[model samples]
Target: MITYRLLHPEILAGLAAAGHGAQVLIADALYPHSTGVPAPAARVHLNLRPGLVAARDVLEVVADTVHIEAAVYMADADGGESEPVREYRGLLGSHRHGGDQEVAWSGLERTDFYAACRRPDVCMLVATGETRPYANLLLRIGVP
Candidate 1:
């Protein structure tokens, strides 16, 4: 009965179970889904093949499903953002929160980013087949 594109039952159930400040990761093809997140977290694989079910695709649908307060992505050493980051920025621009009322677009070092993924707060980890490098994204769930 939902109008949104996210129709998967498992994904909907996982999102419904998580609370405010919880995180959801949209992992790329190279991401270590099996070993990265904790066993308690839900790992939903949408990675059918390379270039299919991209991280951005999951992000767009999940955005419609929940209120995202902040989003984080891996940044390069030189401080330049990737195309995927730019694409995600466009998607997050409308949803703002906190005092500044702006969606936090944070950048983390590669190793640190993976470390963040393993946290217990990561309630849902969507494994995508995005082929681009650094296409991973971490979304912080916000209060409704």
Candidate 2:
């Protein structure tokens, strides 16, 4: 039996198919899941209802399931960190890959973030029900 928090078959298959440097986007309810990512990217919809699942919740499980090399957040309009970003940072901080190597962190404007997600390198896109604005996150998968 699978022993980790991430048990979704499609998610596991997608992650298994993705190699290092592949990106995964865990987006909020407000995100445009259908068109946000490229057509080749695998889609996993966890947005059961309004606030049924959260971007942070998906991030937590994904983080634990794979080795994350970097993290990118959608910056607030004012270029300041949003509340969801702060919460995500805390969660990412608790997970590590390749010993003490720190996960590279960065941010981009809303448009730029969407552009990044549309890139071919993104292997999977997860749509969550998080209601917080600017709660989108893009994670880079790393080697185990």
| Candidate 1, position 143, lDDT | 71
Query: Model 2, residue 135: what's the lDDT?
Result: 95
Model 1 scores worst on lDDT over the 10 consecutive residues at 94-103
TM-score of each: 0.92, 0.96
Model 2 over residues 1-144: C-alpha lDDT tens digits? 988788999999999999989999999999999999999999999999999788888888888889999999999999978999999899899788887887889999999999999999998999999998999999999875
Please, what are the lDDT tens digits per residue for candidate 1 over residues 43-80?
99999999999888888889888888889898766666
Say which candidate scores most in lDDT.
Answer: 2
Identify the runs in model 2 with alpha carbons over 4 angstroms from their true place.
none
lDDT of each: 0.87, 0.92
Q: Cα deviation of 2 in candidate 1 (Å)?
A: 4.4
